[model samples]
Target: MITENTIAAISTPLGRGGIAVIRVSGKDAIAIAERVFRSSHGGEVRKFPSHTVHHGLVVAPNSQEPLDEVMLTVFRAPNSYTGEDVVEISCHGGVFVSQKVLEAVLEAGARLADPGEFTKRAFLNGKIDLVQAEAVADLIQASTERSHQEAFQQLRGGLSDQINAVRNSLVDMLALMELELDFSQEDVEFLDRQEIEERLRRSIEELDKLIASYQRGRFLREGAKITIVGRPNVGKSSLLNALLGMERAIVDETPGTTRDAIETQLDIKGVLFRVIDTAGLRQAKNRIEKKGIAITEFHIEDADVVLFLLDASEGVTRADEKIWQQVERLSQKRREMFPAKIIIVGNKIDLGNQLTKGSFDPEMGKWPLVLVSAKTLTGIPQLNETIFKAVFDERWERGDAVITNVRHLQALQKARQHLGFALETLKQGLSTEFAVVDIKGALEQLGAIVGQTTPEEVLDRIFEQFCIGK
Candidate 1:
């Protein structure tokens, strides 16, 4: 579909830089750009070949006064990002120059592009699908190499291909079911019950796999939360600094230096981890101390991996045992809801004559333990590896389609539920018409993932997360 009005935006981030890019798209993009941009060689911008770049100067429309020297790139209709005539002006990086250039384009008849309008136009014009459109935003916001790779794969249509494959299977089954419905009076069985059940089972299995990937996918997209919990002066803050390669938390000989939770992000082997250093766990000497300890416990509960540090030089004290008891109680209560893994870290091994490997109770139930010296950075690499493995123990291979978006996951879950209902109906020997209802419901849910039947409000919400220039 061709957009009627031209739109313009500063594609590059707003600020002073070597160069800033202003993008214009739609039917009148070329005409609008030609009116405000004067070529260095006195050539017309409209006559430039598609995908060609020319030296130019942006000038005010009425005054014809030079605003800034620029490099103009032309992309003609059916070949541009939005499948429309598009022009990009590379101007001097000054904020005023770029704004004035954008103003010139606006004054020449191009409207300001809204948040994600360029990408939205791509979707509407069939240049990309809904999933790929969202991937554009994901690619922009990706923080780690792993997330960037995932977003790149999605933008290249990996996830969309998987969803389309499953949807095609459902469409085929729906066709056969509809055929059965058309001949209901003839008592003709278009497809055997066994075959129908088998197809439904396979579809459900595919949906189930996508649904199961949400946890790891979410962790990959938004870094896993790792919280450090231990008694005072157990090197919790030191560990945080060592992992981040910077002093993110205050380190001192004094106990309870960290009176609140200090959170920072770290990238390990392409995966992002949010490391949180919390106040030491101990009996409250006063109301403020009690609040800090309470906050520490709360972080422990919500963490993806709880690093329970023990001072190797001091050995496990009675106070340490009490804290372990508290951790155990909380773990037992929320075992099903919050499945955060507990890793026992023995710190300060550089002090020498530290606790032996078997010093802790074997009853701790096989929690992974690593000995480290935070001051000397000894065994720190092993500690990092242990932390990553504790959270992502599943066998995941690259290039596999994973569901990182919560909306997609929810849709897959609903699709699985509907498939389950259809299977149950088939097993109960119900009418084919009854089974058709559940199958169609599953199809609709899957369609929503690709924006085939999604509500307009959902699209707005999803694109609103993107920056205005996207």
Candidate 2:
């Protein structure tokens, strides 16, 4: 494994917790650790076997004063997270004490680690792929059970296995294509054109599914956007508060109470949804309200799911009809995918005036209408289920790998495009060398997802987004 200068950073969050872990990794991790740590066992840090733990006290350099009691763990090279010698000091979690401990370690010949340096080193040293490295961040930031599960699975090589399977197929095909190129001068056909065409077609289909899976995958990664929109005093804000179980949006009887979009998070069935409560969709009476309407239109155009709130106490009125027209017109650019599905909501069902499929024009009637009373939260459980069913259908079967990263999705699309070109070359009876070029392009694109061919700048951008010492 590759080794570099010793780098140390607090692996745990800096605060007044029960304890914190300081990570040291590189060629001299154990040696630097020994300088600042005096083990109770009274042996050199390097002498301890790999994966061994010991009690120690951090000693200040120059003054030789004890800093704090800690438990030091040693990991020898070729077996550590970075595939290099590593040392971990579990110290008391205090703002001042952790700082002092880190300072002592830095003074003991260890350099301060940059953001994500530890995880970056793991990727650079071949301990993990780029997808797994990104998964580390996702796992750390996961807010719901579904997000956590996806990230954990990705880290455990679920996505990597899928990527490698597709990549191997391309590799096998490319080898044969190159072999065919070699036999071109001999007037011998080493590869069958029909077989190559069939294989390319299958590979393209596999890529298409992964690309399509990005819709739900993105929702799992970054919560879904659910915009509640309707005419004045249709209980949009109340619905938002009801769903979030908190008064996140101000509820007022007066119209245009919310002049701007108020966004809050709601977790339904382990999937996150960003519920946005916007100004009632109506003719603006002021400049601020006009801007709010524009903002509402924007949200409607891009929302994953829209809650078209209609007052169930009263049937659809002219104002509701006008707002529905604007919403339909603005949603032209919305994604035609599972996450883009909408559910029409009729609030104030406690008034015993819930609407049905016969309540609106035929076009509006095509959408599912759910009745609820935001004031009493009646039918909220049904509303949650309706919202969830709108995006995630039975298609979300287990073991079907879905890519959550946009970068991975783009890479797959570009790889699929190259493969498309390869199939075209074969179908057109083009030269073997042309197909070889296309296949190579596809290989590089696929390799970039797993970091085999990723550029340095792209790596920098990705790792810089990670937390320091992870």
Candidate 3:
């Protein structure tokens, strides 16, 4: 338990409301509150029972001048967040009032809490592990219902339990191997080589599954970046405005009107997509247009999905053919990295023409194509539905155990690599001692994901992402 000093902060967000909570924790939390709090119900705050609330008046410690009518609640050490004596002062929700009460608490001998200090104390004092500590921030910043559900599950120890289960098995195997070394002279075999190999292989498969799931997890957490690219005056901006259901981008019939990328976020069926409408992919005479094309290229390369727009009325021109060839060549280079999905969209369908059957050759793989007229607001809903289906397949599960944290993903990847080394070593008929080293290293990497073997710096960085007063 952390019992050395008290930490305090205004817990509620800045702005006016019915009330705001100022939280304090540490060994001296109660004492610090009592020094500046005066009771309205004629009971001493310092003498109040733990986990109970009392109406009170906040006053200056030296003069006893009442500042605000308040309610003070107390939690004894080892039972509260941070495992220390904690106090929550309920004051008027006015911004100035909350700030004044917090300042008073600090004046009465409590230090200001840093960003995520309360949660950090909880982690340091063993209330929660590092994975749960990170979940606190994730839970707050979650933008979608699916994200919130996933983060809450992780906060409840879903990931930790899975990691610890694997680590415990590896530790047992290592202990048995070490025991064999101790009794080698006496010819006692504490562990069977074939059985150990089987167990390790199972762990490796499980870890591999987790690492593979990160592709979906990362997209869910960060949202998909979708860039719309096409030649000049192909209604790229109109398509963007149509998708967002707003006039977020300027549109004109003249070519080269869009000279920069316009980005907007949309929640399509609870999945966030950062859609960027870039300058049309065309040869530029103006310096500004050339720069915009460069930026468009940059967004295309970094996008998680590309909406390649084609002018259905004009047909595929030489420039359009060139862009399509470039996309085809680029897809080959990214085959190993799980590259973004591309959709071939034919826009301006309302230009007094009907798109016939077999508009584009399907022989060159199933390039998803959708015909839409941005001017008439036609086919937008279907376009969005297509986007969702293309991104999240039927196998995608929400609230399933997924690793969203990058550090955890990297650690899992390293652990998988180590497990591969162990398997290779065993296959080469190497000594059990060498194989054990690789096995133990893999276990340690997995342990770090759950805070069992994490470094101090990693903990510091994770907690630092939390907002102050969290």
Note each model's CA RMSD in angstroms.
1.9, 1.5, 2.1
Which candidate comes out best when scored by TM-score?
A: 2
lDDT of 1: 0.88
Which ten-residue region of model 2 has the weakest summed lDDT? 331-340
Error of 2 at 271 (Å): 0.4
Taking all chains together, the TM-score of candidate 2 against the true structure is 0.97
Q: Write the per-residue lDDT of candidate 3 for residues 111-196, one digit (tens) a residue.
A: 99889999999988999988888888888888987777778988999888888888888888889988898888898998777888
Candidate 3 clashes between residue pairs 3 or more apart in a chain or in different chains: none
Relative to the unseen true structure, what is the C-alpha lDDT of residue 74 in candidate 2, on a scale of 0 to 100?
91
Error of 3 at 298 (Å): 0.8
- In candidate 2, residue 210 scores what lDDT? 89
Q: Where does candidate 2 stray beyond 4 Å?
A: 334-339
Better of 1 and 3 by TM-score: 1
lDDT string, candidate 1, 1-470, tens digits: 88788999999988889999999999999899999999999999889999999997899999999999999999998999999999999999978899999999999999999899888888888899888998898889899998999889999999899889989998998898899889989988878989999999998888877787776777888889888988999999999999888888999999989999999998988999999899998888999999998888888777888888899888878888888887765544554633888888889988864565566666453788888989999989999999889867558777888888889988998989998999999999998788889888998998898878888898888877878767
